[model samples]
Each structure stands twice: as C-alpha cells, then as structure tokens.
Target: MDIELITNILFAMVRSGTPLLLVALGEVVCEKSGVLNLGQEGMMLMGAVTGFIVALTTGSLALGVLAAMLAGVLMSALFGMIALGLRANQVATGLALTIFGAGLSAFIGADFVGKPLVGFAPIAIPVLSDIPVIGPALFQQDILVYLSLVLLVLVWLFFRVTRAGLIVKAIGENPWSAVTLGLPVLRVRWLAVAFGGALAGMGGAYLSLAYTPLWAEGMTAGRGWIALSLVVFASWRIGRILLGAWLFGLASILHLVFQGMGVDMSSNLLATLPYLATIVVLVILSSKQSRIRLMAPMSLGKPFHPAG
Candidate 1:
C-alpha cells in the first residue's frame, strides 16, 4: 500500500479502537479489585442510547456524555447490588444486566431510530498533525480518542506508582487478608465496579455521539464482549490493553480495507473477523490455564462474606 493509504488505515484503526480501549481499561480496574462484571455490554448500550437522547434533545454533547456515564454507573450499581451486595453469582448477574440493558435501550430508543445528529469532529494538533504519516493518525482525533490515550497512561500509573493502586491489588489477590488487615475490601470493590461502569458508559457514548453519530438499538455490535475478551488477551496489563484494542480495531476495519482494495470477499464473513479473533484468543489463553491463573486476580468473581 502507498503511504497515504497506510496513513488512512492507521487513522481508522485508532478511531475504531478508541471505544474498546476505554471499556477494557475500566474492566482492568474492576477486575483488579476482584470483581468480574460481565455486564459491560449492557452498561455500554445504556450509555449509548442515553447519550444520544440527551444530546439530541438538548443539543449539548457535554451533557450527553455526562448522562451516558451516569447511565452506566446506574446500571453497574444495579449489578453491584445483586452480585456484590447480595452475593449472587457474578456471571449470571452480568448476563442478566446485559439482557436488561439491551431490551430497555431498544424500548426507549424506538422513537429515535434513524435519527441523525452532528457527531464529534476531529481536532488536529497544528505542528504534530503536519508530520508525514503518523502525525495525522495519532494527533488528529476526536476528543474521546485523546482522552482514551491519556486514560491509558493514567491507569498504568495508577496501578504502577500509587498507594490506592496497591490497595486494589491487595484486595484482588486476597480480600480475606485485606479485611483482616482492616482494609475496606467491600467498599473498594464497589468503587472499582462503579468506575468500570462509568468508563463502559463513556465507551457507549463514544459510539452514539462520535463513532456513528446516530441512535440504533444494539449499535455496540458486540464491542462490549470484545472489550471483555481484550482484558483477558492483555493479561490485565494496562499497556497491553492498548495494543490489543488497536489490533482488534484493525481486524474490525479490515472489511472496509479489503473492499477498498477491490477484493471480492464476502462482507458477512469479513464482519466475523473481530468475533472470531475473540474466540481464538480465548481458546489460546484457555489452553494455557496456568499462565492465566498467575496473571489474573486471585479472588476474581468470588463473592466475599465479611462475617466469615
């Protein structure tokens, strides 16, 4: 491919990856605190529909974003109440939340179907964007894209160089010990879940408000599940999450690239690439169970009972 074609592909890759990066980053933090939330897809749909409605009605993207985050937090709170508070099965609760979010979003968004709004536009950094190939792809992006990159660094630092990060890690590894040591294990996990919800919501918002700029039921198109897989694919490492998200993003957009190149492949089959990659990654990782055990949070998905 020519330089221009390569640059455009890179740009599209980053754009495609932004939502995945956001959701996966949050999942890392949530899982780090020993909570396994499978409800990210639900949270994201709630965010997307809520954001689109708020922005369309109020004509303010800022409010829309905040609303989307709030919607996600609310959905997560519901998940937490059942899974964390009531000590229900985490996996079941998460699946239920996804179903609920999907149904509710569809019901609420029925009126807004096919509606259009002005979505987020890219802003170019003057000097940096003027660079040859990489600049535009990296520097000229929508606000959410920049925020995702910044959050990636902040999250890495949060786990690497902060006391709170250590506390989260400690809780994830051994919540019983954390409680014995007088640490607030329950509270920490709750906060982690909430944070995850917020980011998931924001990821959804990016889809409706920036990525596609329209309200459509099921618009996330399994990106939420992909984000969940990405957390595993990255081995819960913050830096690896970015790499994985972008790689998946490239896979997601390959159909468009192939079509541009005049390749006569089945569009339907090409669309399956991202999901197929998810399954393949899980299979590979599952085969190396020992390695995954070493990398994953020790108490993940296990309910805690303080009275024990």
Candidate 2:
C-alpha cells in the first residue's frame, strides 16, 4: 500500500481499538479486585444511548460523556447490590444486567435513532503530526483517543507501582487472607466495580460521541464482550491489552480494506471478523488451561463472605 493508504489504515486501527482499550482497562481493574462482571455489554449500550441522547438534546458532548459514565455506574451499582451485596450468582446477575440495559437503552433511544449531531474532531500535534506515515496515525486523533492512551499508562502504573494496586491484587488472589490482615475487602471490591462501570460507560460514550457519532440500537456490536475477552488475551497485563486491542481493531477494519481494494465478499460475513477472532482466542486460551489458571485471579467469580 502507498504511504497515504498505510497512514489511513493505521489511523483507523487506533480509532477502532480505543473503545476496547477503555473497556478492557476497566475490566482488568475489576477482575484484579476479584469481581467478574459480565454486564459490560449492557453497561456499554446504556452509556452509548444515554450519551447520544444527552449530547443531541443539550448540544454538549461533555455532558453527554458524563451522563454516559453515570448511566454505567448506576447499572454497575445494581449489579454490585445483587452480586456483591446479596452474594448472588455473579454470572447470572451480570447476564441479567446486560439484558436489562439493552432493553432500557433501546426504549429510551428509540426516538433519537439516526438523529445527527457533530462528533469529536481530530486534533493533530504540531510537529509530530507532520512526520511520516506513523505520525498521522499516532498523532492525529480525537481527544478520547489520547485520553485512552494516558489511561493505559496510568492503569499500568496503578498496578505496578502503587500500594492500592497491591491491595487489589492481594484481594483477587486471596480475599480471605486480605480480610484476615484487616483489609477492607468489600469496600475495595465495590470501588473496583464502580471504576469498571465508569470506564465501560466512557467506552460506550466514545462510540456514540466520537466513533460513529450516531445512535443506533446495539451500536456496541459485541465490543463489550470483545473487551472482556481482551482482558484474558492480554493475560491481564496493561501493555498486552493495548496490543491486543489494536489487533482486534485491525481485524474489525479488514472489510473496509477489502472493499476499497474492490474485493468481492459478503458484507455480513466480513462483519463477523472481530467476533470470530474472539472465539478463536477463547478456544486457544482454553487449551492452555494450566497457564490460564496460573495467571487468572484465584478468587475470580467467587462470592466473598467476610463473616464466614
């Protein structure tokens, strides 16, 4: 491909990956705290619809993004009350949250379907953006894209260099031991869940406010689920998560590349690339069961009972 084509493809890859990076980052934190939340898809949908509506009605993208994050937090709080507070089945509760969010967001967003609103504009760095092919792809992006990169670094630092990160890791590994050591296991778990929800919401907001810049039912298109898989694919490491997200993003945009090259293929089948990749990753990971067990948080998906 020519320099311009390469640049465009690279740029698209980053844009496509940003939402996954955001959601997966949050999930890494949540799972690290020993909570397995399957409600990310639902949270993302709610965030997308809520953000779109707020931005469209109020003409303020900031409020829309904030509203989206709040919507996700609310959904997560519901999950926490049942799964964490009542010690309900985490998987079942998470699935229920997804169903609920999907229905509610669709209902609320029905009126605003296809309505137009201006989305986030790309900001190019002065000197950096003028460089070669890599520069345009890396330096020219919307504010959220840059924010995602910053969040990735911060999250890595949070896990590698901070006391709170150690506490969360300890909780995930052995909540009982953490409790015995006088750690606030329940409180820390709640906070982690909330943080995951906020980021999931932000990811959804990016979809509505910047990525597609429009509202549609199920716009997340299983990106949330992909994000969940990405956490595993990255082995819960922040740096690997970035690479994995971009790979998936590249997978997602292959259809566009093919179309541009005048390649004949079914659009529907092409659209399934990302999901297909997800299944393949899961299968490969499943085969290495021992490795996964070694890397995964021991207390993951298990309800914590402090009194017991």
Candidate 3:
C-alpha cells in the first residue's frame, strides 16, 4: 500500500516492458509484412550474450549494442532463409531457432558466467528528473527506455502514413495481387524479417546489459514467447504494444510482490501471470472486429513460389 511501491511498480513496468515492447514492435512489422520470425527468443539470447561479452571486453556501450544487433540479425537471417527462401515451415523453423539460440548462448556465455554485469547508465535530463514522483519514474531511465518510446511512435507513423507501409500491408493481405502490382514482395518481407531481428536483438541486449546486466544461461526467461503472444494481445498495433508490454510488466512485478508478501502461491502459478494475461487480452481483443481484420500477409506462413 506504500506510495513508493506503486511508484516503483510503474517504473518497473516501463523498465521491464521495454524489451518486450521492442520485440513486439518488430514482430508486428514482420507479421504485417507476412513473415513470422519465431526465432526471436534465440535472436534475443544470442544478442544478449554477444552484447555482454562485447561490452565487458571493449568497454564501449555502442560496440556492445552493435554486436548484439549483429548477432540477432545473423540469427534472424538464417530463419528467413529457411522459412522464406527455401519454403520451410515458419513455426518449426522458429522453434528450432529458439533451441539453437539458447544452446549457442549458453556455450558462448560459459566463460562469462559469474562475470560482472555490464549495462548502460541511466540519463536524466535537466528539470525532468526533479519533477517529484513523475520525474524520477519517467525521466530517470536509461537512454534505451526513451528510444523504445521513440521507436513506438515512429513505427506507428510508418504504418499509418506511408506508402511503403501500405505495400507491406498489401503483401501480407494478398501476395498474388501484390506480385501483379509489381511489388517486391519477397524482398520487402526479407528486409522486414531482418529488421525484426535487429529490434528483437536490441531486446536481448536490454536483458543482459541494460535491464539485469547479467549473463545467465537462457536469460530470456520466456520473454520471447511472451512477445509473440503480445502481437495478438496488442491486436498488431504499435500504440497498443506499449500498453500490452506495461500490462505484462505489471503481471511480472505482481509475481514478485506476491512472493515478497508471502502469499504462498506456487512459483509456477506466479510465473504464469504474464502469459495468462496475454491470453485473456487476446480473447477480449478477438471479439472486436477491428482486431481480426489485421491478418498476416497472404503469403505469411505460405511459401513464395515467385514463379506463379
């Protein structure tokens, strides 16, 4: 019931949800472009370990972030190749990618285990951090938090007010029609998948270097999966993604708070809140006709023959 606890909870929601928000943002794009990058979990883990190692050794935050994004891009490209080019199953390919990424991260981080966490420092603008309770929670976060918000707004504009966005949506909606109209469906989708990889990789970097700053084996801790459901929960809208991430963040903090308060709930039950909430949101959202209209590209999970 304390004021700080609620304040801290809000702060924690923003801080914790930043990664999910980023990953969801990219996933929404990818899905809109008709590609489902299920390997987000792997992309994130690889990026996290890569970022942690690079940051620790090079003493450069930028380099660490670049390394993480690179790692994620590489992994996502692999997913794109199998799923997009060779006509493999997106769902299975994504699951395999997750396993591959997790194992690879564990192997890469083996030596880095027990090492100190390396993360970005928080930055507070003048006059912003001094605004009583609102200032500290909102403005006193690391630069990444601010960037996530910026990306959210920018992506929304991209979808709502751009020709390219329309093309991507058209491709997702009807690939054959897009092809007839002379759109580069495959190429555009490939780029979307790659961008999605980079964004999800940034999410990974947040977990290892920015959020917790520790390299744990499989440190993503189901966030990747949660991000996937978030697409449904948010109804594939960037604006709603922010709200979904915050909701998930609240669920996560609630789990911790319950534990601290000695509520005697099973650990597994507590851990299920985020996923459960996502499902509930999806159910509520599905009843709305507006949400159902945004289906993935016609060729999304379908293989692109390109010859027809």
Clash number for each model = 0, 0, 2
Clashing pairs in 1: none
lDDT (10s digit) by residue, model 2, range 134-185: 8977899999899999999999999999999999999998999999999999
| Candidate 1 ranges beyond 4 A from true positions | 263-289, 292-294
Estimated TM-score for each candidate: 0.94, 0.93, 0.92
Q: Write the per-residue lDDT of candidate 3 for residues 49-115, one digit (tens) a residue.
A: 9999999999987888889889988998999889988878888999999999999999999999889
* Candidate ranking (lDDT, best to worst): 1, 2, 3
Q: In candidate 1, what residue range of length 10 has the lowest lDDT sum?
A: 285-294
Runs of candidate 2 with Cα error greater than 4 angstroms are: 262-289, 292-294
Number of the predicted model whose TM-score against the real structure is largest: 1
- For model 2 the local lDDT of residue 67 reads 96
lDDT of 1 by residue, 47-166 (tens): 999999999999999899999999999999999999999999999999999999999999999999999999999999989998888898899999999999999999999999999999
Ranking by TM-score: 1, 2, 3
All models: lDDT? 0.92, 0.91, 0.85
Error of 3 at 291 (Å): 6.3
